[model samples]
Structures are given as C-alpha cells and as structure tokens.
Target: MKSIVFTFSFVVLFTQLAMAQQSNEEQNLIKLSLDKWQWMADKDVEKLSQLFDEKSKFVHMSGTWKKGEELDIIKTGRIWYKKVTVKDTAVELFGNTAIVWNRITLDAVVREQVAVNEFTVTEVYQKNGQDWKLLALTFSSVRDTHQIKH
Candidate 1:
C-alpha cells in the first residue's frame, strides 16, 4: 500500500511539473543566457559588448573585472572560453530585472593552460526600453555533485 501511494504521488507531481508553462519573458531570458554562453565560447566580444552595460562587472575564478577589462581579456586571448556545457538553468524575474543561474562545466584555456571546472554562473540583467543588458556575471565554483534547487 505504501509503495502504491508513493507511485501515485510521483506521477501526480511529474504531471503537474509537465503542465506548468514558463512565461514568454522567462523563456526569452533563458534563451538569452544560452546565447551568451555561446558568444563567450566563440569570443564574439562585439555582441557581448553591446549586451553588457557600461558598468557591468564579471567575477571569475581568477579574479573580477569591469566590462572593459573583461572584453580586453577575451580579445587578447588571455582567457579563452573554449567550451561551456550547460547542465541546467533557472531564471527569476522581478519588475524590470531578471536573474539567471546556470549550472555548467567549463573547459577553458588560461595563460596557455587548459582547465575544466564546474560552476554555477549567476547573471543579472536589467530590461531597458526594448532590450536587456547584463549588469553582472558571477561564477561560483561548485562540485560536480552540486545542484541548484528549483
């Protein structure tokens, strides 16, 4: 009887989750986050520069820097984001702001050495007019077994 009850509860919970739909804005934020990851890996600093606000900030394992310094690092190959494999992503919206959390495995080249690490990347974006600009991007190192609660 206990096993049967557990099975029923699991089915109901899964059904409810599947039926839930994310709003358009939430979906757009998710898409933008994914695109940003791709742009970083490709070293498309032009698009990134446009997306990042003038006062934007970036936090990495090595250190933290402002928008200009971050762009210069990417342009000069100081730290090449060779590949990023996103395991999962979550986004929250407030008025005109959105925060995204991405669980990823990063494979990068830094100072001629390649390293792979797991990180939970948090991105904060502000909506202005018809576009959204990134205000902050922070990387938090995490264990491979770590998971973000939804």
Candidate 2:
C-alpha cells in the first residue's frame, strides 16, 4: 500500500510540473505575437521581417492577399501604419502552433490616403527552435458602430 501511494504522488507532481512548463511556453508565444504589432507601429520593417517566416502570407485589410513575406509589402508602399492600438487580444496555442486574435485600430496612410480603420486581425505563429515566427495573417476591416444617446 505504501509503495502504491508513493507512485501515485510522484505521478501527480510530475504532471503538474509539465503543465506549468507548457503554460509558460504559451505565454511566451503570445508575447512574441504582440511584439510584432509593436514593430509594425514603429515601422520597423527589418525587425518585423525577422519575426515572419520565409514563406509567410499576409492578407491586408484591402482584400489583397500577399504572398512571400513582409518585405514584399514594405517594398510596394502599400502599407504604412502610423498609430496602432491593440485591444481585446487573445492567444491560443495548439502544440507548436499558436494563433493570436485582436481588435486593432490604426491611424495609417495606405495608398497615400490617411485613414483610421478598425480591424480584427489574426496572426498565426509557429515555434522554430527556441523562437516563435509568424507564419500567416489575415485581417478584416470593421465599421465602428457606436450609438450615442442624446
């Protein structure tokens, strides 16, 4: 009876430790996704490129789906973000892949037009070695519909 109890206790302790380690991994992945948003706000295309995979795909809010990587978008003058505010951010992890969804309001100059657009953005990330890299992204524009009672 004593040996059986000892074995059960060890199994429970090991399982809890494994769970804690997995939680930390998920949190770190979410942080990496958030950092990409910061880089976009700063217009740091170089840093942003590092976060993206070589074959990453980016679907812009304009309904254009770009292939290749962030460099292609940066070269075309198609994306110029000024101020970006992330809201209601949520992250979910599945094995080595993670997805981050958030509401983003941006003061951007796209195609020479200064616009304030609210969008729901989803960023897909994959863990590579010790770092997380963005594998794809899709964003859709949302109309801010708020009623003010007079």
In terms of TM-score, which candidate is strongest? 1
Expressed as tens digits, the lDDT of each residue in 6-118 for candidate 1 is 99999998877765644667888988988988888888999999999999999998899999999999888898899999998889888899999999999999999999999
lDDT (0 to 1) per candidate: 0.91, 0.74
lDDT, model 2: 0.74
Give the TM-score comparing model 2 with the true structure, all chains together: 0.73
Alpha-carbon runs more than 4 Å astray in model 2: 1-23, 67-69, 75-77, 143-150
The alpha-carbon lDDT assigned to residue 109 of candidate 2 equals 75
Report backbone clashes per prediction: 0, 0
